[model samples]
Target: MTAPTQERYRILALDDQRETVLSLQRALRPRGFDTEPYTDAARALDALASQPDSYDAALFDVVLPDVSGIDVLRRAKRIAPDLPVVMLTGDERAKTAVQALHAGAFGYLTKSTDDVDSIAHTLAQAARQRLLQRRAAQLERSLERVYGFEHMIGQSAAMRRVFDAVTKVAESDFGVLVRGESGTGKELVARAIHERSARASGPFVALNCAALPEALVDSELFGHERGAFTGAVGAREGAFERANGGTLFLDEIGDIPPAVQLRLLRVLQEREVVRVGGGAPRPVDVRVIAATHVDLERAVSDGRFRQDLYYRLNVVHIDLPPLRDRLDDVPLLVAHFVAKHADRSGHSPPTFSPAAIEALCSYDWPGNVRELENVVQRLLALVPGDEIRPEHLPSRVVGASSGRLRAVVVPEPQPVVDDLAWTDGMPFAEARRLVQERFERAYVTRLLDQVDGNIAEAARRAGMDRSNFRRVMIRAGVTADKPRRA
Candidate 1:
């Protein structure tokens, strides 16, 4: 098989030895590189200052005849702050290596230990790292602007509906709740609304409620005094206070414990928050946007979630469609990801063959758009070619039946045995008691897991008394690891 055409990279190589510089040029040529060799550090600095962007990276000897390589590295950085510079040394002194790193060298390598191939690898890594940093900075700035139809890339009807809804939703300050499966970009929709809303100039804070422990949820949502709880060395502002006069995005809203939910409801109604420790109620002007994957309507009916809180947060609901339901947008999304990943990796975007695109569209992306982006990034970094073929795709995506969108995942109902089923001999009261017991066990167990085995919080959220909730927890075989707070 013929070798893959490697990406051509230009470099400025400086060394005191002319023969060492000459040998480097010949060694790197086969690796798809062209070097501008310089034995003098002054001349090398002049070249870099004259045309900074001309070189993809810089290679300098740590100890030069006239000046130190660290000086040249510093100069290169100032000229093109994005340029990656690697330092090389003949001596095995750790101090020199540390100094070079402290001076902002992309990488440091000892000449006797690292081979040509290793050096080449480090240079490539540096280039990619710098490119990724630049991409992140650009994206950060882009997010601060108003988002509209082009906020996310797609031409499918489902995506069009989402964009249109976002435009209308941004016109008002109504509380928004974005509903979608994991990886469906719920946070992206929240950000789009925040950027376009009147509070664009204000802070847009986001927190994943599911990621925090139940014990800390209170402190995170509401500020705490210096002596509020354990490890409270200093007073800290909570998400609500930090997001005052702005927007606060609460992700995984369904996971919030019942006690916190009650407090959250109060905050929404009163437009003020009382710190965890004794304190005066401070008014806040935060517009909340929540996101969730669970079927909240069912949760409300099950009494695991508060009904009044649901109505307040669900003022304007936006449901994002899974990627499989909008397969027509696969090719467009694939192209966008390719360009994005390639730019971040410092490589030209490779084209995806029709067969490859077909395979991608055929696979059911259970993880949604986020999964697709990850796969594309992997292929971009590993696939060595100008075009991505069906053979280049993962085995799972190839030959897979892109059937209908996978069913929304939910907890399965418990099996009902003959004894559990109602009979003519059983009285209505007995039958009702038996069925209610089963439900209490199942709901209590699930809620315990949701709250990270916090029985007290689960009971409070379910609006059940503590001892009563403990009795149900015992029947459900779920144990609470946390002691009840007085």
Candidate 2:
């Protein structure tokens, strides 16, 4: 396959001397750079103001009749902060170079010592730096879109419903309850709510109720006096006090002990919290966003969770769908995880083969997105091949294919009741081939039937490339029988 070509970097050259401009144009054009030369510095400055993004780098001559290159650099910076500027000067004064550097010039080249090679080399470096800067900026913006207000990445209808609910609840001051299976990003949803709310500027505090000991839950939620408990060395502020005028995310809220639950409910209702072992109640203006993987209703019914607390937190609810239900998003999620981990480790992520992707999509992700990310990290770390095949996947992921395709997999054909009469009469090889043919036919029939005669899903479930699977179907004489998707 042909590799994709990169866009050529454009250079804006501003020099009063036409000869000097010609020299630069000749030097750079051979190196595959597009040079836009200007004899008037004023015109160049105007272009910079109007079309700052059109050029990747600028080369400015120090002395111009209309305006000094330094002035142009300052103005250009104000208009486009990221544009790389390289100063060109006939004067070899060290102070001039110093001044250019102070004005944010990426490079300083003197016309006397500046041969075609040197000028090209310096400008090339500057252009490359510009490209890097642009890429870094693009990455930052991409990350913002991925991890911003709608940070939970999903295009599925189920996730769209969650996003809609979050947007509506964010404008209100009602307590929010985020419910999902573990590793489904309950905390991300909670953070999205807080960031979208009026309290976005306020501190966002998080406390995992299940992570703390029963003895420390109360002290952690509502601060404690210096002598409130044995480990209470100082007058410490809790999540509630610290998150005043902001948000406090209480994760695993259902796991909190009953005593702490009561205190949490009171704080939610009254908008105040009395520190542990303290008599006075202090007013706290905090929004609480609670998350839990367990069903709070079931916990409440079982007397393990408090009903009032559940109701308080459930005023605004967002139920995140598990990864298996939104399998259509698996590819997108996989690519995202690969890029994320690759960036962290400073390595290129391996590409997944059709069979490898099929293996991933076929498996039911019990641990959800978190597990998928972990697997991607593992693949990047361990897989030496550029392309990841089915063999590169974890055994569990590949093994899941059988379980998922079990309904369509052909089982061994049973013998007629009380007999091996046919086998007794036939040759061993012939009988085995006959049984295999029957199994193939049955497997194809069951697969096509399960997918409503759609060959695509059947092929996918079989963990074969589409074209290869089609060949298998043809060889098995099943292609003509299965209907194509409309």
Candidate 3:
């Protein structure tokens, strides 16, 4: 393994006396300090002003030809107030030393004192103090990036609740259950929680329960002994073992087989795991965070999932609203994804035309945030121009507007026209009713198709709310599995 790099201290020495500055540099060099010696006080002040906090400390001579070292000390303090400045004087007058100390000097040293060891000790202490301050500032910036609300973009009330739940659970070690559609960013929320928790310094392990094979699911979660199975050539560790002292995020948890579910429950209940074909149970300290697009409660009620496991994992439930329910966040999500991909591909960031953004906002995203990200990446890769226009979007979006218009202008069949009484000056109410029914059918069908026929999400896009949307679906005779929404 490679050794870690040791931290180095940066020090600047300003004085008109070349001998004193050289001596200070030599003394600091032995202690692993990166030292810069300058005889001109004016030049040193200019450098400090250009990059405040550039050096951990500065040793200044009391006398200089052009500018007094005390003036340089005052100016350096103005640039970086916390920077340590030790004043050196040839005269040992108590009054001069007292004045230098009162003028914000970290220490006052007489050149004739010849105490190299004492000066080096004082500078080391100052360097440590400065290092602590820098570390504190860095930690604050990291915290802001991890927990800032801006990281999650959504203004809808449902999304607001999700934001609140994330904040509340971030401080706890209890298992979290994130339920949402496939594209709704459940993993992002899981990562955010792990980053904000006390275990941020530890590893974060993730596995997709639905993606793994049934036979391998158990060994994949709980490690196995050497020669446990044909493929188990050597002792191996699983996600739970790898995530010890940190967090293990189980994605699509509802799909885990019944046998795996029982084992998972044992781990959660006993805080220990027994590897496959292993003799004894090994204790594990891991925070559990599980997510699934399916409704675990409903699954349990229907006998498709274990009720005890559902309750164990559902200590903190965070339901992510689908993309359609939070249409207002499209522009923000689009901007973020564009910048992200642009950085990765080393391409200039692209701009979105108003019509393009409008098209995105108006259309229902069945796949949720994941679909939006894919669409954004696709537009960036395919659209050649600097600006993305409505025409640049995928065919599904461009066709939506035109198809709705055509459906309204032209009746589909003869029976439909006769029912509407196409004779000129037909009853106003009759025409209006016909138009309303046709528009609802077309609009609902289109939205359902956009989401790939997720009725719960289709209703959200239709703005009828989930339950009301289901009622309307019954009225319009729509089914879930038809791929009309996909």
Candidate 4:
């Protein structure tokens, strides 16, 4: 088992007898345990309840003044189910031992044992087991942070294809063209590729072509000698020279001016760059990753983007699918965004209602993943409660799902059995079946309606897998017309 950190493992110990607590602390303290002894069981229970994950393991005497050890053990398990509880008592009855173990105690030991060595040994083993279990849980959480690539969360077939392409292209230094809609994380994909490449240790320089002025395009791509232009107060290295032995990501490459495009092409072909207004050519061992949302082929045909430069950057092409095409990944992406926002805001992640998730999934994300993240952040900041429901979602999202605004129209309250009339001679089993059917219909109908007929979202809210939830809907004879196909 993995041991706790090098510092003493914090153990919460409770015993009605002050002397016994003192003895326990003395015995364990010498062996690298930092024990917090409490004579009253109430205080110990309170501490555990308040900070469930703080202590590595807890020790309780089977008989206590405030409460029974069994009761404390049961409550501790409820507070922190994974917390290891070891029962220690002066009584050595087999029945007590059975009760302690049955109540989720990791181990049971008698204080009257002649071997002082055995007491410490048993406690140490239980504490180590708890530490190891906690460590494993921590590792699992860390693993959850990674999906397809660093910070790129998606499991859809479209994303898997992108991941596969990245893996193949990252091994080489050939120029790559990443084509995707705006806010589709083109730069993120480029960074993911560079991270997996041989030049991972090298710097990644990024400059957006569309964001830069036409005059600055040439100076940005290639270094400029001192006094090369009005702003050239000092000799400065451009993106190519600065990104030497690394990667240069040119975003919106289609927007690059014609003259700058030729210089970029030469840098790619000759693996070198000559500073503007300078006679000397400086060789650069930099990989080029260009991204553009515009149709480069069409641009080339229109005499806009240079055909040769387009071909050079298009050695390997990776097309990121828009969020609308990969709607199945919405739930995953929403969860990632929620957690990311919650961490930054120092707030516990609020729950997303099935209806809210449905609204998110049904809408065509024209702004893509970036837009989704922004929406989630907005909800986190504005939503009052811990649960984000359909009513809490922005009206735009609800309307976009069906291209028309839909509101939850609550019908006037009526008697639950108003629709069903039970006859005096009705059999018990038949009456029960009818009541069950009515209840199922009402429950499923309300759930489906709240989610705007998104079955997947309804199923998630019901805490069941999609298949099982679908079966439940079918069993209840409930049919829902969703805005989008799951």
Scored by Cα lDDT, where does model 1 land? Answer: 0.79
Ranked candidates (lDDT, high to low)? 4, 1, 2, 3
Question: What is the TM-score of each predicted model, taking all chains together?
Answer: 0.66, 0.59, 0.54, 0.58
- Candidate 4 lDDT over residue span 1-486, tens digit each: 222347467789988989888887887777767789999877888998889888878888899876789998998899989788889888889999999999999899888735556666666676666665554444335334345375687777798899899999999989999999999999999999999999999999999989988888888889789999997999988999889989999999988888888888888899888998886899899999999999999999999988899899999999999998987677667766765555344234576765577678778888999999999898888777678887877787887765432222212123346654542466988667856765776777789888888878988898999999877765554545564444
Better model by TM-score: candidate 2 vs candidate 4: 2
- Candidate 1, residue 452: lDDT: 67
Residues 8-86 of candidate 1 have per-residue lDDT tens digits of 6788999999998888888877776678899988888889889987788888998887787888788778888888899
Relative to the true structure, candidate 1 reaches a TM of 0.66
> Which candidate number maximizes lDDT?
4
With a 3 Å backbone cut-off (N, CA, C), the pairs that clash in candidate 3 are: 366-451, 448-485, 449-484, 449-485, 452-485, 452-486, 453-485
Candidate 3 lDDT at 74 equals 84
For residues 358-426, what per-residue lDDT tens digits would candidate 3 score against the true structure? 567667788888888999888877777678888888877766544221111111123434354443485
> Could you give candidate 2's per-residue lDDT for residues 211-260 as a string of tens digits?
99898888889999988878778888889999999999999988888878
Q: Tell me the whole-model lDDT of each prediction, alpha carbons only.
A: 0.79, 0.77, 0.75, 0.79
Off by over 4 Å in 2: 1-149, 403-486
Off by over 4 Å in 1: 1-52, 64-68, 71-81, 98-151, 343-351, 380-387, 391-395, 402-486
